[model samples]
Target: MQRTILIVEDEDILREIMKDYLLNAGYRVLEAADGKEALARFEEEEIQLIILDIMLPELDGWTVCRRIRKKSNVPIIMLTARVDEDDTILGFELGADDYVTKPYSPAILLARAKRLIESRYSTQENHPYEDTLLSRSVHVHIPSRTVTVCGEAISLTHTEFEILTYLMQNQGIIISREQLITKIWGYEFAGDDRTVNSHIRNLRHKLGKCATCIVTVVRAGYKFEEQI
Candidate 1:
């Protein structure tokens, strides 16, 4: 089935441009001129992902994003004109999976969209760790892409879960950030060590303090400590 993408942008020109490009890329596209309409369409249609603009009528992107998170985990890529770091950080905190600044390259946006969809919806039946032994306290269910710690389900973002699973599968081996970026993000993350750090921080926070599974190696990378 062809994936459907809902684009929420106030700018008519940019919205049409994205629709054209995404349609050419073989994705079914839906367009909304404001957050209100976007939310309505989101409820009415089966959208696989969203490309949302921060500025909109009736409601802003942050609120829209928050509302969406309450009901769904569909991947969101936010479009912002502000260059402020705080804005970007707030977007992520508000549940945006990624961000693209204004005047962005169409090719880059397309690539990012494709990557997010592929990563988010990819079937995990081929995961090598499916048959591996895991403690009842620490469950790594590949098919569901979920981990339960001590019978409590831990919610992890796509990137965070992938990173944790990879580390656990290769326990005791120090894996570099570059290797992680390539394997997890599906691209070479140049000069972007912070991306890896941010995901690790979020992963750790979600895993709670008691789960000391990820060990950091100074001047190197990270490794997963074997469960005792």
Candidate 2:
């Protein structure tokens, strides 16, 4: 089955370049010059992943992402021209799965798209998590990539999911920020450490009482204790 990608970029050259790359990589490509058309294409097609631009006409990427998150958790990769850290955080808050800044290599963008799509669509039967992980009042179903605390579903960003999954998988082990950046994001940089911290903070907050399960080590890293 060919996975479909929706590229919602306003730039004709960039959009077409992305389309060509993805098409050559064996994916079905959908295009939209603005957020309105993007949403329309999203509704009218079986889009598995989305490449969205922030400075779109009619509807901005933030609004489009918020709308999509209202009803769906489809993976979204934001394309931004700004290099502000706040923009990245805001993108995550808007439910974007990942992002690429302007002037990015098309090959890298395509690689990220492939990874996000694969991660989003992988099922319980294919990517088993050994077994469900339970601690105190928290329940984590790895294959399904779901988390529930006290019987209520706790929505997590894609990064949060991977962070929690990695920590829990190595329960009782101290995992460093660098390790997490490499393992989860597939890269490490000066700013990536802060990104990991931001995600951990948010993850802990979402876990509520079970937040204590993830213990922070001074000047080191974090460890997920099985019994708090």
Candidate 3:
């Protein structure tokens, strides 16, 4: 079945443009002119992802994003006109998987949309039902999706968990940022490699002293070293 996407924007021209591009990309597109209509459509449809505009009639995108995050982790990409860093960070804090600044490229937006959708579905597909045991000072619990470093549970975000899990599952194999982005972030990452670097930084921060389990090869990628 073709994945469904809900686009909430008040601008008719832009909305239609986005819809056309997404449709041609082989996605089923749904459009709402305002947040009220968007919420109504969301209730009525099995939407796989949402493209939300920050400025909307009756209700704003931030509120809509908050409402959706309360009940679902379905990926959302926020559309904003401002270049304010706060807006981007706030969107991420509100559970937006990504953001697009307007007047945006339809192609870039489509690329991001494809990436987010594939990331969500790919993680679901790659989720290991079977368990694995790791002997490193860190013990990763696949079923619970948790990592224990020296008997202390290390907190990790969903993305971090997925990245670590993928690495540990394929221990000793050098994996590149491109591979991780493709496998973990879902689609071909068109953005800077810093995105991957930032996530890895956060993962290591959470890992604390046990971060050494994840080895970074210079100019290469990363690998999970089995502890002796």
On TM-score, the candidate that comes out on top is 2
User: Residue 20 error for model 2, in Å?
Assistant: 0.7
State the lDDT of candidate 1 residue by residue for 1-228, as single tens digits: 799999999999999899999999999999999989999999999999999999999999999999997787788889989888677767766667677888888788888899888877776664455644365356677666677877787777666777887887887899998888887766622225665777787777877853577888998999888456
Model 3 is weakest, by summed lDDT over 10 consecutive residues, at: 185-194
Name the better of 1 and 3 by TM-score.
1
Work out how many backbone clashes candidate 1 has.
Answer: 0
- Which parts of model 3 are misplaced by more than 4 Å? 123-228
Off by over 4 Å in 1: 125-136, 188-191, 226-228
Q: If both were scored by TM-score, which would come out higher, candidate 1 or candidate 2? A: 2
Candidates sorted on TM-score, descending: 2, 1, 3
On residues 157-213, what C-alpha lDDT tens digit does candidate 3 reach at each position? 556767888888778999999898787655644444665676677677878887787
Give the distance in Å from residue 189's predicted Cα in candidate 2 to where it truly belongs: 7.5
> lDDT: which is higher, 1 or 3?
1
Clashing pairs in 1: none
